[model samples]
Target: MAGHDLDRSLGLYPTMMISMGAMIGSGIFVLPALGYKKAGPAVILAYLVAAAVVLPAALSKAEMATAMPESGGTYLYIDRALGPLFGTIAGIGAWFSLVFKSSFALVGLGAYLLLFAPISQGAVVYVALALAVLVVALNVSGTKMSGQIQAVIVTLVVAGLLAYVVNAGFVADAGRYAPFTTHGGSGIITAAAFVFVSYAGVTKIASVAEEVKDPGKNLPRAMLGSMAIMTLLYIGVVGAIIGLSDPEVLKTGGPGGTASLTPMADGAGALLGGAGVLFISVIAVVALTSMANAGVLSSSRFPLAMSRDDLLPSSLQTIDARFKTPRNAVLLTGVVLLLLIAFVPVIELAKLASAFQILVFSFENMALVAFRVADVPSYEPEFKAPGYPFVQVFGFVAGIALLTQMGTVPILGAVGIILGSALVYVAYGRPRTDRTGAIGTILRARRGEEDDGIAATEPE
Candidate 1:
């Protein structure tokens, strides 16, 4: 594989914040409402199912990230354990997922902006694209700046959740959430399947393994910690919404349904006063900005990966010697994200992204198994999955189950991605540099001592 450079300015704290920032975004404030629309009051069960699937997946990624301790997150895992073909496929699948999800974040941005700006309300399309552009610009500057922005965004996320928990967790009526199963069992399960996309960003933490400190420890902690935090917040926020409203009112695909968080927040206001709605609105806006912040940070690394591998034009891998950042790659990432804003909806993009990521994650789990079975002596993972193969097995099954639940469109979407990647491989997967460890290892060795230390090389 052709070698390329990336800045190492991102560290454990910043990277963890990046992952946390990404995971906490629209999934908390936005997807819950979308899930409510899909399954009504029974959405609580959906949260459980989503968390069940994603927790294991996160653990699986933690294991793989520790083993690889390099860039490309799961992409490196698959390349080493499986082969270059599978790795390339995994990379494409994951990259596509991030792209789609980032665009969906912009959709939320547009929706939230419309709520506050009358002009934005009239120009939702333009505003969504504009938010995408703005976020892209922020990320393109450099990883250090991105981390600082994410720090601010993550703070707002915490404050927003704090607001919701205080008023709704304490003051809301309980009877409104009655029976809890009002949305039907299967519907709740389906909604959970959809909401799994909320957890998608958690694995993105592993993408910058080399840039982090004490990665094996901190990455796992951040992965599991953020998941727990978000899960609790989700339960609280959704609990508040349900506690304050009749399921039938927030209900959708039925007789009387408003089917948005707005209705739920309005009900909270009725019970807790207008201050409750104000609280929800403020959090909602913060959620929008933070979600965008998350989207831009992790995604800019992809073009760097592809360029370094020669899968994309080499220009993308260029690093500014002064800043040590891949400005070209960041710009390309933004342009692609911007183009996606016009066409996709949050739920649709969420489903598609979920399917794509599930495929990559499943392979990553399998990679753990493959590496152990192959006994490749050069690699000894610092953090291994507890139960070794069993946890990975559980993760694999969970991914399959979620994919099954996605029905036809998502499944086909995943299949199409793999097939498209295969076609690309047939054409461009040459020199087999895209191969497992051979070319990448060879290139890194050749550049040893000739490098400025900015080259992305695995340490022997």
Candidate 2:
């Protein structure tokens, strides 16, 4: 596991499925209830607004990924544009956030399984851990296998959702959609902030940009395409739930603020009775498993990328000789996922994941801005993000605004991760190399000197 490169096994359709599958999980399945609680029928608008806010970051990532088409995605852009210190932070934060979110998806998988059959409480953990193993094994087997599985899962989930939306339209009572603005504009905005994390997965295709066929074209197309498709799905599904379920049943917070997380199933029960419930339950499991698989596939690349830059131990840089995958990094991420599912209350930690996603997207926009301002000659992308600096700036500001809505603990957690990564950079990464970023190139240019920094990797 030392010299092989990750195989370019993913095409446009599979890559697009990775983006869509990662996003269609617990975010739409469970959280819509909470959004409904906040904005009533107007939660549909919240989904729309959240996608609007996420669009800029998606475009920014597309532009940068086309230019650098590397495995690290957000971390790669930030490192090359801002400097290694910020890169280390972005890399570590991204890895953990993805792992946490994936672990939460596995846990959600377990919970949804319980709805299918009566499993003991302890068995849920065992079930999730088992699924984690299978997901890890799938990723370790090969990227092509993982992407293929993702394609199947996404197709099934999307087809089920589309069917549900169309069928529910026939039976759903118009009165349920009445009083749409139950909570007004402020509620819609707050719910939008809450659901912003749902769209975060759109840009994740960039993490595996190095393994995507014709990346300069496919990377942006996959990302933007998934964003558009998933946004519509979210709105449609949430609208169906709002229309099919009674208002009282859709409201969250049963006891001790524990929300009943089965609004989708309840809506299904209304649509076609017990059979509909079973169908949605099966769909939920497949969707959550898809998210977990994608998490393992993408998050593992962070360590591999960081190791290549000497931000972490070089052992992680090794690729499996047979499969050409980051075997060590995948194993390590799998271990963390198992630990999280076994002990840590990952649902609570998921808020931190959401916070980190907001931070990462903000950094992504900022990185694009930095690169464009530096005007690096080597930074030519096949597809540039339209609107340039204004889009990037709005993305950054909107990300910050969404971060504020996540509350204090999550904000502190994001800050703590940043600070700790900085410490690690100073102690471990800074001494290893004098690799400079685009900004450094600009500073050197201002001094009337030629700069020889690490902008050497040409687009794939």
> Which pairs clash (backbone N, Cα, C closer than 3 Å) in model 2?
none
lDDT of 1 by residue, 101-181 (tens): 777666666665565555523365587788877787766665454556658867776776767666766767777665666
Off by over 4 Å in 1: 1-19, 119-123, 146-152, 204-222, 245-273, 320-328, 431-460
Q: How does each model score on lDDT?
A: 0.67, 0.79
C-alpha RMSD of each candidate structure in angstroms: 6.3, 3.7
Per-residue C-alpha lDDT of model 2 across residues 27-53, encoded as one tens digit per residue: 888678767877878989988888878
Candidate of highest TM-score: 2
**Shift of residue 374 alpha carbon in model 2, Å:** 0.9
**Model 2 lDDT at residue 307:** 90
Residue range with the least summed lDDT across 10 consecutive positions in model 1: 451-460
Please give each candidate's TM-score: 0.81, 0.86
The alpha-carbon deviation from the true structure for residue 351 of candidate 2, after best TM-score superposition, in angstroms, is 2.0
